[model samples]
Target: MMTTPARIRVAIQIPPSRADYAAIRRAAAQADALGADAIFNWDHFFPLGKDTSGKHFECWTMLGAWAESTSHAAIGALVSCVAYRNPDLLADMARTVDHVSDGRLILGLGAGFREWEAKEYGFEFGSPAQRVQQLGEALHRIERRMTLLNPGPVRKLPILVAADGAKALRLVARYADIWQTFAEDDAFSEKSRLLDSYCDQLQRDPATIERAVFVDGDPWTVGTRLRERGAGMFTLMTRGPDFNLDGLRRWLAWRDEHNAQASRS
Candidate 1:
C-alpha cells in the first residue's frame, strides 16, 4: 500500500543496558558494517528487564558517539521520551547529531511511560492521555525550534513516532514521517488500517509515512506477515552483554531477497 522506498529495510536495536560500552559500540559498528539500514538504542534511565539494577547508558550521548563511529547506518534512540527534556533542547540535540552523522539521524520520539523513571529523574509522568498530549505539544515546539536554529539540521531530520493509541495515531498522521509500533500481527494490521483512515481525514498521503515494526522470530513467518501488512522497516533488537547478532544474517538475506522480488515486480 505504501508507495515510496520500495525496498524493505532492516535495522538493529542495541539496548544500552546491562553491558559494557565497549560491547555496545562493537555491536553498533558491526551492525553498520553488515549493511544494516539503521542502528537504534532505547531511551531508559534503567534496564527494563529482570535485571532492573543493571548498568545503563543514556541515549542521545551514545547516539552522538555512534554518529561519529559508524559509517553507513542511520542512528537514534528507538523512541526518546518527550518528558525527559525540553522540546527545543531535544531539537537542538537532534540537529547536532544530524550534522555529526552527516544527515543520518532519525529523531524517534514517544510519550513517557515509566512512572518510576519519571520519579527518579524528577520529570512529570502524567497520565497516558496527558503524556500523549505533551508529545503532541512537544512535536510542535520541536518543529518550530528546528526552523529557528542557527545552523539548522543538515537535512530535514526524520521524525519517528512510536505510539499505539488512537490519539497518538492521530498525531502520527499529522506529524510522523515514520511510525514504529510493537503490536502483534492482528493488532498491528488493525492499527495500520486505523492509521490509514486517520491519514485520509488529515488529508495526508499514507505512503509518505513509513511503517516500522520491532521484529523477532523467523523472517519467513512473522516478518512476511508484517511486510504483507505494509511494514517497510523491521528492527531487530539485541540487548547488552553479549549483544548477539547471530540472527541478523538471516533477516538481511530475507531483506535482499524480498527487495529483489519487489524490484522485479
Candidate 2:
C-alpha cells in the first residue's frame, strides 16, 4: 500500500434529485458548516435511483450557487460527465467557479456512462473504452485552457478523477490530484494497488494523489478499514427531499478523531 502522512478528509455528496433546489442549497451549506472538507453533487440531466422522473437540477449551475452559498468547504460535482460539455468551455466554467469560491473548487471528472441519458440528450454513447479515451483528451484540453485563460484560476485547482479501469487509472496517474472510486474493502485495496503500479510507471509519487472512496457503511467501521488500506478521504452520500446530515455528523466526528490521532503521531 502507498504510505502517506496526510490527515483524513471527509466529503459529503448531496444528490440533487427528488427535491427542490432550495433544499439542496441548504444541505450544501449545512455540510460546509458541519466541517465537511468538501461538498459535491453528481452531474446528471435526470434523477437517478427509484424516482427517475423526479425533479433535478444541473450540476455546474448549482456549483456556482454553492460557491456563493458556503464559505469554508470546497465544492464541485462528485464527477462531472466529460461528454456533457466542451472541455474548453468546462475549463472556463471551472475557473469562474473557482473565483466565486475564492479558490475552493475541486474539478471532479469522469468519462460519461448511462447510455439512456446520453441517447436522450443526443450525445453519442460510445463504447466504454472509447469514452475513456475521450476523457483523456478532454483532460488535456482542460489543462491547456486553464493556462490560456487571461486571469486563470485563483489557485492551482485540484483535479479529481473518478475512475477504476486500467486506462482510466493511467489517466488518473497522469492528471489527478485526488483519485476517487466506489470499491469497498478488498476491491478497493486491489484497485488502489494497481493505481500505485500505474503511478510507478509514470514516475509519479503514488502518495501525491489522495485516495478517496465512498462510505457505504458506518464511518467508524468501513472508513477506518479503508484508511488502514491507504485511503485518506471518505465521501458520504446523502440524497435530497430531506438531505439528512446525521450520517455526515457521525463521519465528521470520525474525521476529527482520525486527524487528531494523525497529528498526535
Candidate 3:
C-alpha cells in the first residue's frame, strides 16, 4: 500500500466553461475556501458537458490565473493534450506556470483525443493507439527538455500520466510519478490491482507511482471503498462558468474527518 503524505487529499476539477469569468472565478474561490488539497481544470477547447456553446477559457491561461488566485494547494489540468503542442514547449509553459504558482504545479498529461476539437482547431487527431503512443513520446520529450530549459521549473513538476491500458501502465512504470485513472467505484480495485501487477512485472517500485482516481458519484459509499483499496486521492469534477462548489465542501469535510482518523490510528 502507499504511504507518506499521511492524510489523503481531495482534488477538485473546476472546468470553467459555460459561464462568465466572474462565475468561474467565484467557483475557484469556493474550491479554495473549501480546503481542497488540489484544484484542476480539464484541458479542452470546448465544453465537455451539456453546455456545448458555453463560455470556456483555455487551460494553461486559466491555470496561470489559478496559480496566483489560490494558495497552499497544488493545481493541474486533468490531462493536457500531448498532441496539440510541441512537448518541449508544453514543458516550458508548465515551468512558467510552476513559477507563477510558486512551485504548485502537477503536470497531468495524456494523449490527445476529441477529434472535433482537433479538426476545428486545426490539429491532427490520430487513431487511439497512435495517440497513446504519441503521449509516451511526449513524456520522453518533456523530461529531456525540462533539464535543458534555461530556467528550470520552480519545482520539480510532478508528471501525472493518465492511462489504464497495459501499454500505458508499462509507460507509467517507466516514466510517471503518478498514474491517474478515472472510473466508477467497483472498477477502482480491479484497475489498481492490474496496475500493481504491471508494476511487478516491470520490476518498478509500485510506490514510486501513486494511484489516484476520480469519481462523479457519491463519495460516501463509492469513494470510501476506493480509499480502502489504497487509492491516495480523489477528484470531483464541478463544471463551470456558473460553477458552484457545494459538493466540494462535503468532500473536503469527508477528507478532513478521514485525515483525523488516520492521525489517531
Runs of candidate 2 with Cα error greater than 4 angstroms are none
Worst ten in a row by lDDT for model 1: 1-10
> How do the residues 1-265 of candidate 1 rate in per-residue lDDT, one tens digit apiece?
4343577899989999999999999999999989899999989999996668998999999999999999998999989999999999999999999999999999999997789888998898889999999999999999999999989999899999999999999999999999999887789888988999999998999988999998998999978888888889999988779988877878998999999998899
TM-scores of the candidates are 0.97, 0.98, 0.93
Better of 2 and 3 by TM-score: 2
**Ranking 2 against 3 by lDDT, winner:** 2
* Per-residue C-alpha lDDT of model 3 across residues 1-265, encoded as one tens digit per residue: 4333456778888876877877777777777777888888888989885657867789989999988888878999988999888999999999999999999999999886688888898988888888888988999999999999989998778999988777777778778888898754556666666777778887877767777888656677766777777777888887654566777777788888889988998
lDDT of candidate model 1 versus the reference: 0.91
Instruction: Return the clash pairs for model 2, or none.
Output: none
The residue-level lDDT of candidate 3 at 239 comes to 63
Against the true structure, candidate 2 reaches a TM-score of 0.98
Candidate rank order under lDDT: 1, 2, 3
lDDT of 2: 0.91
Best by TM-score: 2
